[model samples]
Target: MSEVTERRAAGSPADQRLPLLQLLLVGFQHVLLMYGGAVAVPLIVGQAAGLSRDEIAFLINADLLVAGIATVVQSLGIGPVGIRMPVMMGASFAAVGSMVAMAGMPGVGIDGIFGATIAAGFFGMLIAPFMSRIVRFFPPLVTGTVITSIGMCLFPVAINWAGGGKGAAHFGALEYLFLSSLVLAAILLVNRFLKGFWTNVSVLIGMLLGYIVASAMGMVDLSGMDARPLFEVVTPLHFGAPSFHLAPVLSMCLVVLIIFVESTGMFLALGKITGDEICPKRLRRGLLCDATASFFAGFMNTFTHSSFAQNIGLVQMTGVRSRFVTVAAGGFLILLSLLPKAAYVVASIPPAVLGGAGIAMFGMVAASGIRILHEVDIVDRRNQLLVAVSIGMGMVPVVRPDFFAALPAWMEPITHSGIAMTAIWAVLLNLLFNILGERGRDALCGHH
Candidate 1:
């Protein structure tokens, strides 16, 4: 094993402790970086679930609590359930689109939502052992394609936020650009001018400055902040409990499968980026962590939980590979979630502000993928098809989301997802063309 892998195998423990101020600051930086993404799933799902106003509000709170718990579990190893790498967990953006589709379904109400998510988590857990076998397939070539595709897929979402997000009548207006640019500029300026700890949270500092400026200009709104309670008891499966029928369970089963594949690639990407050798054991542990979080998120009234690539980008950029730092952040997130007012403070980040930072952070995730693939030897002509086919398949959902409209509603979870399609295609094709050899499939296996 490499030196990096050796160090990671012995993951950091939080007991060693740090200065109170420094630890608190790092934790806050993590919350700032991931708040938009963590809340997005609930915000979108709450609307689609036709939840009452108060219920919608609770959903957001639930998401925050669950996300914090998930991050802590992921960062600090728990049984077979953590990668012990510097991965930060949150509500997966991958599951968001499918959750929207599921919410719009006629019979699958919020109960169905819970049931499906729970089923998905279990299904994802069941497959971890099998999926870990495919880790070897993530050569540089494949990782690059997926990472680049990830960035490409997220680019529009970021751009939309930069323009004040979807449905803005004056989308792309100057005010929107000014705010986003200011935030972006703040991040850059901090990186350029600040030293030590401040430089580490350049993005967070920039965002705080933007929020202050926006508030002074009357762009920030806190009228409803005082109305929210500072504490709300989190009840598991608070929406009348999960009603697991055949179809919804089946629908989410596929969702979990896709999540597994996507996460495998992500873990591999992280391992490669950190110069850690991701063996089958490590991948096993990582996926186990995902499954636990997925299950936990379902019970807590949220969507799937997986590592966020954006924070991985932050790690790469900051060059701080300590899992201990993120564990501190996770504690902070949980504490904030416990305090409703504090959670609201984070929940109140304008989507547009998030959009600006999101663009930078999410784009960095995709970039990380590209870095992984750069090491692959793709010069051979045969390897080109692998990239071409996988990429083409991945772009389907991106290019035409409704392309599979005619497919059964149950199939929406997999068919409509470019990420899933790409993952399946890449894995299958690798086993086909790359593993079996060109024009020798039938010759060797005698089964074609």
Candidate 2:
């Protein structure tokens, strides 16, 4: 047998080891894929709290540091804490609306946000075992519907990036469109002609080419980067001691529940991509990692952390299933957090370029979901109704972010999240039409 084949046969794809260079490059590719999202929570929360430029920068650094630590623990794992999957951890955007609200409260500022985060993290950890039991509900019917909704929800983010990012001065500029197209074309060409490693790094190569073009067009901004420090360690509690309030803690706990639902879908999606079965035990580990990471994030001056769904697409596109790639990516995140200049350089990659890659990657996620659905008894009327209605419900928030604004404030956590919405409906519908329906049939037979 071939040496490569022998090596692959020796371990599960998730445990396979690659060459050091491949590890770094592939890991960096994962990093690039997720960096935009990893920093977004801090950026939004910082601005919402009216933090100054330096304070925001501090928040970003703290977030990166915590994210790095979380990702490593998740991928490498320590005992029962991590899932040991190729999962990248990042601050959860699901918490943004709640956090923004908390930021505006009279006494519940950033400190209260952190305090609530800590409480919620603890709450999540406590309930993770119970939540993991929900895996049985996610047959192909529910998994496919939720995964499809995830990709569909992300499409708007991709389109906005293609238009030069939301709220950019040159939003929808022709240059941004051209740049996005160029990057997309490059990626397609690489995937068409390249083999093996080249194909795996296609997105990275496309982004690099786009970055060069953007630099020539004066779109790669490096202004004021030199003024930033050469190195700095993220000091925990930089925002001061957290002061918890009952209301904020409860709100954040709701966000944690939302995160758990979202992470379950993401973990299952990754499992589908990597050919791993996300058994209940494994799901429990993944949830524990998320909870532990978020708990630490509160003290480390960051927000809640969850498995990043976008990276699942990269794994699907690249066909690299090694969890260590994420370990290396976590290492890079640590370095970036320490070296402000390095982080800025990576941050400079135009959103247009990312948008180009995102179209392919995010579309792959949707495709994977459809592939899973292909295995379902899709011809059955009940299953068909389940998939159709779940996905439609999932799109409500994506189609109109404020659709639930008129609803009570407490419902925001579930209503705002398309993944959560999809999962909830799909599970309930599955129980109604499949599990409970089967029991009803048995009872009728007994009566007869």
Global lDDT of each candidate: 0.72, 0.89
Candidate 2 segments whose C-alpha is farther than 4 A from its true place? 1-10, 439-448
lDDT for each residue of candidate 1 in 1-448, tens digit (9 for 90 to 100): 8433456466533222446676666667677777777877788888988898778878877777777777777767776777777777888766666677768878888877887788878888888888788776665666667766666666677788778878677998887788888888887777788787777677777778778876777666677888888788778978877877776677667767777777777777677666777788889888887877787777888778877756766665555566666787788777776787888777666656766776776677777866655555566565578778987888888788888889876666577666667767776776776666764443222122
Best by TM-score: 2
**Model 2, CA-based lDDT:** 0.89
- Model 1 misplaced regions, further than 4 Å: 1-23, 97-108, 193-196, 438-448
TM agreement with the true structure for every prediction: 0.87, 0.95
Tally clashing residue pairs in candidate 1.
Answer: 2
Question: Candidate 1: lDDT of 55?
Answer: 88
Per-residue lDDT of model 2, residues 122-202, tens digit only: 999999999999887777777888888888888888898888998679798999999999989998999999898888889
